[model samples]
Target chain A: MAEAREPAIRTRGLNLWYGDFQALFDVDLDIARGRVTSLIGPSGCGKSTFLRSVNRIIERLDYVRTSGSIEVMGQDVLASDVALTQLRREVGMVFQRPNPLPISVRRNVLFAHRLHNPHGQSRAEEDELVERVLREVLLWDQVKDRLDSLATGLSLEEQQKLCIARLLPVKPSVLLMDEPCSALDPEATSAVEELIWELRGDYSILIVTHNMAQARRASDECIFMLLGKVVEHAPTGDMFVTPTHSETADYIEGRYG
Target chain B: MASPGGDRSGPDHLGREWWWDKIAQVLLFGGGISAIVFIIAIFVFIAQQGLGYALVDLDLATYFTSPEWRPTSEPEPVFGALALIVGTASVTGLAMLVSVPFSIGAAIFIGEFATGRTREILKVLVELLAAIPSVVWGFIGLMVMSPLLMDVFDVSVGVSVLNAGLILGLMAAPIMTTIAEDALKAVPDGFREAAEAMGATRWQVIRQVVLPSAKNGLVAAVLLGVGRGFGETMAVLMASGHSINMPTSPLDQVRALTATIAAELGETARGSDHYRVLFSIGILLFLVTFIINLLADMFVRGKKTAR
Candidate 1:
């Protein structure tokens, strides 16, 4: 499997800081093609920070300094040759907050699709893609009736699904979600987890979650982190059942968060 | 969360406290009502005295379109307010045209692109400009602005429509920049972030997201600046040439309604056509200011929840 499978993203000696405060340090990680990897850690442990660095979103923030080499599809992402716009297009993100723009739901989903499409798509093709993505997120039935309504009026869960559906129309090769279900109830969480599982068939998915059980349920492999360091990484079942590191064991046992 | 001491009872004497509270309430309500009454009374008196001149003139052609504004013995030479209105509108329009774009651009620069020390310096400079009295601005217009304009454009008195407009535009700039900066600051950071996340450039974000979101406030600022320029007395008197003749061009000398009212109001005999003419000019000033203010209010209020 290692010989046949290629890494979609490879990070080496990654370090990030907000002013003088270090958030991520000397991290080396690999993300495989067409896999779901969940990053689980306590709050302020750099899970979301790592997720943001994947697409240079952190670069937009002031007082943030990142020193790292991130390679996606065997190209150096930080290099000038690899355009940030193109990199972002290839690697899409779903934020912690469900920020569906104060626009119609159909427009919200179709915006990402039209981003790189200079000639744009036909109306029929656009509608079909929107409907297909909405269905993939299990939101078409509920929202198909009022796709014209403002996306902000939707419930939090529905908004999150809409955000996910919005990204799907873009067809990103990698999807990074930063605690996409933390704001949701159990039923909504289950729906999102199922959607994540379904999405794994097409694209590589990296999700940051504080919910350890959610990490277990949604991910193929689990990366446990503490204090800006990766404590352990293994197959989800193996990591949860027999974590190699004592810190991972304690974290999984809920002995100490 | 109990108090450390065991003194739970409130107020030593409730009767005196309640009476004091009632007095405070009465004072507050009285102050509020007095302010409202004062504003209403001014408007009522102005309208009552000025309405006769506005309405009693039956011939629209004779009152509005007639070029002559001479007062005579018969019926006291009915003085029309149309020229005054046109003068005020024209000057205000010129001032706004010069000020709005530059002011909004200054606001965007300070609010969005400026660094720490530069932004602070610009803010302080704007406030200092606002603090300068109208008389001082007018003096600058007379001594500095007028001569510079005369040299450049070769007008007779150096005090023409252009001179008054340039001075008014300068005076209005601080107000516009400050108000527009406040409005731009009120826009949520989320809009900027959203635009940035979409791979939009810095200029694109300011244009498409921030400006549109803050459009109502910016428009209100510009309208308020127009009102300020229209009613401005000292600066207009000093720089508008005080010519009774209608303005033929920007460089040609002209008088503003505000300057006319200020220069003539004290000497004109009460209950005469001349007196009524002054009041009529006041009424025109009031109407122009009122309409602009109302438009500003509508834009500011309507745009609050437009998103």
Candidate 2:
């Protein structure tokens, strides 16, 4: 039924194992397009694993084994014929910690763009691209004069914004963020949350967060997961007011993690 | 309790502790300072002994510019080191050319691609290569490599610059591979994951992300390898034939600075001009290695500051 509605990302029978220990158990999810879907769960509840699985980054670990299907825009991303590079280009990721390359801020923004589009861009085009993305992330004016400076010199908040900006050049359909603002202070968190709110309607955003308030404040829809299974997925307001499952209610009320 | 100083008070306890502390401090300081003192003493001694002959007695211009290196001749003994310098440069250059690609490739393979049992085995093998003594490597070059080169190139003499370079490359590869692999391994997993998330291929991630992050370390590795190649003696002494001529081709028989010193140091009498000239060559080798290490240190410091 969710698939019929043309969701941005749809997963079916998604199972994952780390060596002998299974982390996910037949997880089926349908994340809608042009909406912010927040995945909230306790630690080690497979939230980050699920996000990494969507982009096939989980495969980087030699011990990780994943099963079942993940589809992005009607294409089966888990299919053997699907090129990993192609899947990744369409589905961008923001990690728990902002990992900007040690290169200059401008080069960090252009890295993925250059890799995906090897045909090359002119210097003026690169400048425009940098400006547009940095502006979109609300970081252009602060970082404009220091575009040539090393990205590692930026503040945690600016670095996280830069990380998000770097993903925009490839024009990914779905953005998977795994605790993107977990490292920031309260002020920086709100700023990043505002940026995420601004980014809605243009890209389908799936964020995993431990902060219950963040999930409620930032997301249009909230997905509550527990013990590697989805407990509830509902509108943000409805989920907070009246959770269908007791586990979701317990988690939201901070009764028990 | 009564103390030997006859103070028998709390202040006496403090005084006793301070006395022991001073002794310990002096001992530790001496231990630390001795290393620097020894290095400075060696440098001063070498300069005093060698500079008298190299700079004061002999023409400094001829020592650097003239190719003729005859130390024993009628009326005039030429101490020019131009040929030996060229020999050292060419042999080291060739060794680098042969070893750099292989070492870096092996390092990348071991550090990035290899996993599980294969990585362990390759690492052990590299360690074994490094453990092999310099003399053994020289023997291998003299017995095995020289003949192979002679047959392959159809040259009259098997021991040539090419042979020395090849053998020196083998001698240097383990050091290069081990250090370069460590450099590659030091690249954080986050960079790799970030690049992978961007849909970059494994090779692309290595080239665009990993290598750039590890650039300073890699440069340091190469500089260390160059220093190792430059200072290596036994392998070059055995395989290079020690023909004191400026090498025109890799196949030409040549003499390196290390090989020159090793071959002539024993034959020259103590405190003779020839002996002091050998000391001068040692000074040159010292300066070269020191500069390379200094450059490597700068790169390492730069990497630290950037991070």
Candidate 3:
């Protein structure tokens, strides 16, 4: 059993609201550490909201309200004195769209590291870090010669890779990807899926995706959410073959989204 | 017309939308080209009015170097413009110093910090500030700002370089803030979200990502403000004291080129050297504003292609 190991993220009785509208119900989940777990559901099912709740990025909206607890790497992030920057450093995120800074590729990779280490590392150390992270994202060979060029100039796939690369320098314990490849083409999607797979075991990744096939192929564990509640959490093969709930089965069979 | 099963004999249409569309196209084209036509017409008119004096008998040496501008003396009327040029430059330079910080700060607050009713209210107030007439601003400079400056700096005269600069700076700030806010708004919110997600503090995100991302547009905003300050006449005329002195300090009184033409053009007889020289000043003002505007436009376009 994996009982001896601590979970990467633990949510207990978590509820969320946006002004008058409640978006998430009292949901509880324990995402196993260092695994690729995909949250799959229909539109407005709150899968992405649940993912955002863990890192508390949605708090940027003034009207958003949350209760209960979300602990990232065993720290209760919802506590007032908890420094968000520190939490964000531990739990990095990639958005639905590849949102790389309008800066050089080399700087993009080093953005988070610079945030954490204000005094900064020397040029050789930074160069090594950039190379190491870019290589980890499988993007170094293509962008090696153009490190100083704008990251925005890269293709969507490369941009997405760069976005992921930018997060790695901070050595985040968890990476939450909200449909990271939805904007990418099929070829790019598979390429990014492979890259995501390559990143597994090194970092705990909770990915929210709409594609059933991608969920089946890419993730080790799968969770099905409906109406802001977790419907099922099982191994990817078992869930696809024999879903625990009819909603999960219907969702997988394309009966209705 | 042809039957469904039969071959067509000639090209034909059932709809009557063709002629209306043609008329609309002609009308829209005329509307689109009116700006270019008007600009060219104005330039030609200014050139025609000033060409005789500027080309034939302008005393190029005295016109540029000498500060004496006695255009109504009995024996000999000097036509030097060095003082007027410096006056305009100094007023506008001081104005930029006062306006840039206020404009950028207000823009950042409106675009990045303020929300809900506060944002809407601030935006409306800024726009109202811009809509206030230039003459009214001149009145404020003459009646209020000048006296205030005199009290603050312990100067004998109320209207000086400082007074005009303060008034013009306030006058120019609304437009500058509006444009700078637009520039900041143009930077996609995604960049802010991306930076914030990277453990960057709010200030860090703005300083490192948002400002740099919107740098071109912000520069364009400042340049446009400079253009606004350059062509402004009424406010500069009222606040700049209309003195012909070459200023060595902020307290010294000076006169702007725009003020000179606005003030002396009516008094001078038609076709006189003074009249033609006023038109020459108009030509210079036109050229300076045109170049500043062109540069601003290019910077705005740079932001577009960067994405």
Candidate 4:
């Protein structure tokens, strides 16, 4: 399986602290290429922290410190020499809520593209790019008639989809989603889950979720975490059916979070 | 159905409490309503006195068109307001030109870039600037800025439209900065995060996301600044040389509407045409500031609803 291939993201001895409070232990992980890897745990288990660390977004907070090496596409992202903008261009991230710029839908989709490609694009090229990305995220048919409308005016589901669509134009290799569907209803969650599933084979995705059923249903590989430590990382079916550790077993069986 | 303790109090107690509540409500409402009433009364009084002269005693065409503004001449007192209008416009326009960019930049720096102790210090300094009185600003203009202008521009008299504009701009900047900073702070952090995650630099995020989100508030800030510059009297009167002529250039001496009214209102005879003309200038000034403030309110409201 392609899941057995080289890792898209590899981290070693990833320890992180916020101020004096350590949030991540000596963690090690190898998320496979072209696979949807779900990081699931109870609240405050540092699942989101782990996901954010992959893209180095946690460092945005002044007090955050990490002693780790995170390699994306075989390049060390933790190195001081690496340009942040360049690293981020190769790795896109979506937040807990859908946050498209308060601009028109078309501009929200084209913002990152224009930023990365400052030489500029022709009108036809921009139109095609917008449509292509929107269609990939299953939003083109719904919002095609009102591309100039403000993105914030859309329903929550469409806004989430648009947020995802905006990332595609940058052509990042890996997409990190931090509870991307947390703000949506159940039906909208499933819709976004399907979109994420569809995107799996083309892009390596790391999704953090507290929903066990969502992790089981949507991911190819699942990593269980507890107290900033990884308990088990296995194929989704195997992890659910026959967990190696008692913690994982208890968690899946709904014995305890 | 007797209560544990309330049975001891009769309906009269409830009635007394309700009566006191009504009195409190009336007092609060009256205080709020009186402000509006006073505003309307002032407008009515100014309009009645001013319109009587403008419509009856004055030649409307010469009042509006002629640059000559000699009101105390022997046979026929001329009350041309064209020069005063130009003076007000020039001074306010120059003030906006000087203040807008600096205020916006300062606001962006304070709101978006600075952090921790630096942010706190800058904020306190800005508030201190706002607390300084207009009369003190006028004093500063008279003593410090006027001499600087005289030395730098080599003008005969230091006080000119440019000098007044520079002083008024300084006076208006604190308000502009404070409001603009609030608007910038109001932009969601999620926008910055999203832009950054999409490989945008800090500058790119600010320009494309933060600024566009805060556009309405920024425009409102500029409008408020313009209102401040328009209505300011003492500083302009003290620093503008109070010349009653068309301001040919920024360096030329000028007299604004506010300055004219302040300088002449106390000296004019109570029932004379000159007194009514001063009131007419007051009406014009009031209307200009009123329109600017109205526009600012609309933009501020637009920002709120857009969110």
Highest-scoring model, TM-score: 3
Residue-level lDDT tens digits of model 2 in B1-307 = 6758756665446676688999999999999999999989999998887877776777779889988988766578788899999988888888999899989999999999999999999999999999898888889888999889889999889888888888889889999999999889989999998888898888998998889888898899899989999999988888888888978788888888898898888898899888998899989998999899999989888888878
Model 2 regions more than 4 Å off: A1-4, B1-34
Minimum summed lDDT over a 10-residue window in model 2 chain B is located at B6-15
**Which candidate number maximizes lDDT?**
3
Error of 1 at B250 (Å): 2.1
- lDDT string for model 2 (A38-112, tens) is 999888888999999999899988999989999998899988999998898899999999999888999999988
Query: Model 1, B156: alpha-carbon shift in Å?
Result: 3.1
Each candidate's fnat, listed in order, reads 0.10, 0.85, 0.88, 0.78
Q: Which residue pairs in candidate 4 collide?
A: none
- Per-residue accuracy of model 3 over B1-307 as CA lDDT, tens digit each: 6576343444465334556788899999999999899999999999999967788888878888989999998778899999999999999999999999999999999999999999999999999999999999999999999889889999878898899999999999999999999999999999999999988998999999989989999999999999999899999999999899899999889999999999999999998888998898898899899999999999999999988
lDDT of 4: 0.91
- Which whole-number lDDT from 0 to 100 does residue A97 have in model 2? 97
Report the candidate with higher TM-score, 3 versus 4. Answer: 3
lDDT of 4 by residue, A1-257 (tens): 35456799999999999999989998899999988999988888889998888888787788899998899999999999988888888898988999988999999999888988999999999999999999999999999998999999999999999988998998989999999889999999999999999999889999998788999999999999999999999999999999999999988888888
| Stretches of candidate 1 exceeding 4 Å from the true structure | A1-4, A80-82, A113-115, A118-129, B1-12, B15-34, B57-63, B71-76
| Chain A TM-score of prediction number 3 | 0.98
C-alpha positional error of residue B85 in candidate 1 after TM-score superposition, expressed in Å: 1.7
Interface RMSD of the predictions, in order shown? 2.3, 0.7, 0.6, 0.9
- How do all models score by TM-score? 0.89, 0.94, 0.96, 0.95
Q: What is the full ranking by TM-score, best candidate first? A: 3, 4, 2, 1
lDDT of 2 at A115: 90
